[model samples]
Target: MDKFNRKSIVLLVGLALLLALPPITIAMEEAYFISLFSRIMIYALAAVSLDLILGYAGMASLGHGAFLGVGAYAVGILAFHVTEETAIPFLPGGWAGSINAVISWGSAIVVSSLFALVIGALSLRTSGVYFIMITLAFAQMLFFFFVSLTTYGGEDGINLDQRSQIPGLDLADDASFYYVCLALLLAFVYICYRIVNSRFGMVMRGCKQNETRMRALGYSTYRYKLICFVIAGAGAGLAGALIANQSEFVGPGLMHWTRSGEVMIMVILGGMGTIFGPIFGAVALLLMEEVLAAYTEHWMIILGPVLIFVVLFARRGIYGFLTGDGGRDG
Candidate 1:
């Protein structure tokens, strides 16, 4: 009860701050923070998506970035075709492009979910280290595949002509986009919270604890996990689309295995198995980078030790620490 109260306090305070951040930054003449926090929220979304699988389902995926990249490419390619006034090569007829956020971003979610479906189907067959390695390998495959697309700028990446269009709002405005990202993040977090508390969530946790026991109970753990994996991929895809809008660019680097490692680090730093933990992790890690990088290029030297300390001592991560939770997971 005490822990719940503490967590509630933190959540309330955090939400209030986020809600007021744009105006606060404008008043302080630090409007740049709006953009920075926007990026942070985007990554927080991605981290939360990963937590769905890694935390509750015990599926540690290293190819998660592949979904992110696929989603971004979905947006980028669509915008590119529209801007160039050319039909998409693979599609029949005059399926040119779309600037609609709903269509383009929806494409991102659908395509990424499909990709995750295929990858999860194959990769989930293995367990433990093999699963980790296979994910990493698939991510690498995607990274190189994107790199080879010379038309899309390949290793150099491609630029977005403009932000996705939403009716009654101009996403080109930093503040507007920031709020959109925040809204999506909050919604995704809520959805994850509901999932974690549902019967499906219980089954996921059971599989995480003992797959054999879950199977003996007539649970098709594989199907449940696959569904969970697809849902996570869809969320990550949304994050990727947001990131493309935030940066106004997309590239193969988005799918790199190293990026996956960074996100996993964020999850670990925040608190695995806790839906809200990764958001705190993203904020902490990114802000640490922003502040420390301004001081020196060797910020990693400082960050390395900080992460080591967190992993060594506060194993449950920043959220766990703040909430006074003593358990290892969530």
Candidate 2:
């Protein structure tokens, strides 16, 4: 088959699988499948964002989960204080209005972006282990700060009275919500594809391969890093927003260091730097967790070794074993 035909078939098949998922998981309600897919897509978006920096730009961060937490908390808090009118969230300080859910969703994106910018600016100054720790410190600070906000939920979390309502659709329905999450996943992936191929993306990758070399060529690596960091934060924040809406709840647990580690693991497991890798990672890990937990209570006992083996044996990740990166044009 021609490459175009092959790709189209693949895409069609993927859509078929997703559409079939709700009915296939009859034991679990369609709502459960929808909820699971929402979680998967959100985390996949966050993973893709981290991949931009860690995989493409050669910057490692340990505090990525904080952005997700910030986005979610923003939704939780606003829904609490603002109108119950199912409005889109706004950008911070009422910048944008009525995105999807109208004002509320816009607010979510803005808050996440701003939070990422400030955090990335400070953290980018450091490199290697120092950068990792600094990011972690900042993430932990946010985590604890929210935990201390007794009004919101403190150590616990707050629930959404209602999910973010799509403009004309009832997002409360399982099928509709699943499609929304899937569409966003594809949209975010397309954005990454565009960004990675653009002139700016070329500079970002060049900076990743060699900061000094890129700088010598007259590129400001710091600016590239800052931009990439903001993008990553926005992605994570999007995930947070989805999670809040999916569970109808938001809490500090989503921002913890361990949560950050989970995303990192997803990236690595799916094959760092590959476009499809992070999403694969999220699916494989989550599915594995589901299967193992069903078989036994001590699932972690099996999980730890499986992860170790993958790290040691499948170093290039699942994708590397299936499709050679050098074989494909990026």
Candidate 3:
């Protein structure tokens, strides 16, 4: 009970700080942090989505970054057509590009979900290290595929002329965009929290704990995991769209296996299976990179030991340590 209270307090205060960041940064004339923290929240959204599978469902997907790439591409390609005043040749009805956030970002979520569907369908057939390798292989396949698209700048990637339009909102304003990202993050976190507490979440976690037992009980663990994978992919897709808008660019690097590894690190470092923990992990890891990069080029050398210390001693990660709770969701 005490631990729950502490966790609740920390989460509330953390959210409050996020809410107040724009004013705080503006007052200090550190307005650049608005963009930086916006990027952090976008990655946080991706990390939380990864935690859905890696933490609760025990799925180690090394290719999850592919979904983000696919999503960003959706935005890029559509905007490309709009910029060039051309329609996609392959599709009938002369479908052209659109800067509409609803069309572009919605397509991102849908297309990414479909990508996850195909990937999860095949990937879930294996487990253990084989699963990891297959996911990595798929991610590499996608990375190279995007690199080959010379029209999208090949390895150089594509750039957006403007941010996606949101109804009555100026995404061009850093503070406005930050709040939108914050609102979306809160919404998705709430969704994940409900999911991890629901019957489906129970089955998913049970599969993680003892798949054999779940199968013996007549539960089709594959189906549950696949659904969870799709859900996570959708969340990641949204993050990708935000990334494209935030950076005004989308590159093949988004699909790189190393990117997936970074997101995985955020999940584990934040506290796997705890919905709110990865947010802190995202904040901590990114802030470390930002601050450390200022001091030296060899920031990663310093980061290695900090991560090692967290992994070795703070087993429950930053949030878990703060709240005195075990890392698991339940």
Candidate 4:
């Protein structure tokens, strides 16, 4: 079979396996794995968003976690208001709800995109390490801002009484929620695939390859990069919203620099610029974390070497290795 057919088969099999997990979990009485995989799907979404900018656009933002936190906080804050029986002061009609997934997730994406616009406009002026630092600084600032909000549990974080409602779905059930996450993950991956192959994606990739040439060719690379940044932020915000529902908690920790680093690592480890690579990286890293943590607390010590080996030998990441497409730009 050709490479395309092989990849299609692999993806189809992976999807089938995920789809079968709920029934298998019921049989094995292993409900916890369902939740675990749900978390993986959420982070995989985040990693894919990061790949859009970091891998395709050549924008090494270190503050992507800020968008995730923004989305989580959107849900957390709205839920808090609902629980308190108070209307949102800033919202014109005093909108208040406990489990409106659409509103909360929508707010997350909008807020994160606005934040991205502001940050990108400024940070894009600088390149290289300066850009990275600026993004990190902005994320840290937002992290502390949430930390100072004593009304929302501050550093301790806030918990939702329950997951957000999705019409007739029972999000409280692990199996049901796992399917929700899995479906959203598949949708996000498909969207990213489309974006990475379209005309806009070509322009973004061109900017990554040779910005000066693209600029000389009359392409406004800065604007394209900023739009890409906003798109990535919005994607991360969606992941954040899903994660907040899954965990039923939100905190400043979501925006911590380390979280951003983890997502970046996922992108790099999964083969930069490859649409499906980050998903592979997320699963590998998180699964390793879960399995190794059970055996030893110092799992990072072991994982550190594994990451190094991938970086040095499998430079294209696990997805690249599996597909025999190593060292080629996806």
Tens digit of per-residue lDDT, candidate 4, span 134-224: 9999999999999998888999888999898889989999988888888888898899889989999999999888899999999989999
- Predictions ranked by lDDT, top down? 1, 3, 4, 2
Distance from true location, Cα of 223 in model 3, Å: 0.6
Candidate 1 residue runs with Cα over 4 Å from true position: 328-330
Per-candidate Cα lDDT values, in order, are 0.93, 0.79, 0.92, 0.89
Cα misplacement distance, residue 11 of candidate 3 (Å): 0.3
Which regions of candidate 4 deviate over 4 angstroms? none
| Pairs of residues at least 3 apart in sequence or in different chains that clash in candidate 3 | none
lDDT of 1: 0.93
TM-score attained by model 1: 0.98
Q: Please provide, for model 2 over 158-237, each residue's C-alpha lDDT reduced to its tens digit, 9 standing for 90 to 100.
A: 87778877778888876677777777777888898789889988888888777898999998889988998898888888
Error of 4 at 58 (Å): 0.7
Model 4 residue pairs with clashes: none
Winner by lDDT between candidate 2 and candidate 1 = 1
The candidate with the higher lDDT, 2 or 3, is 3
Model 3 CA lDDT for position 35 = 100
What is candidate 3's CA lDDT for residue 279?
97
TM-scores, each model vs. reference: 0.98, 0.88, 0.98, 0.97
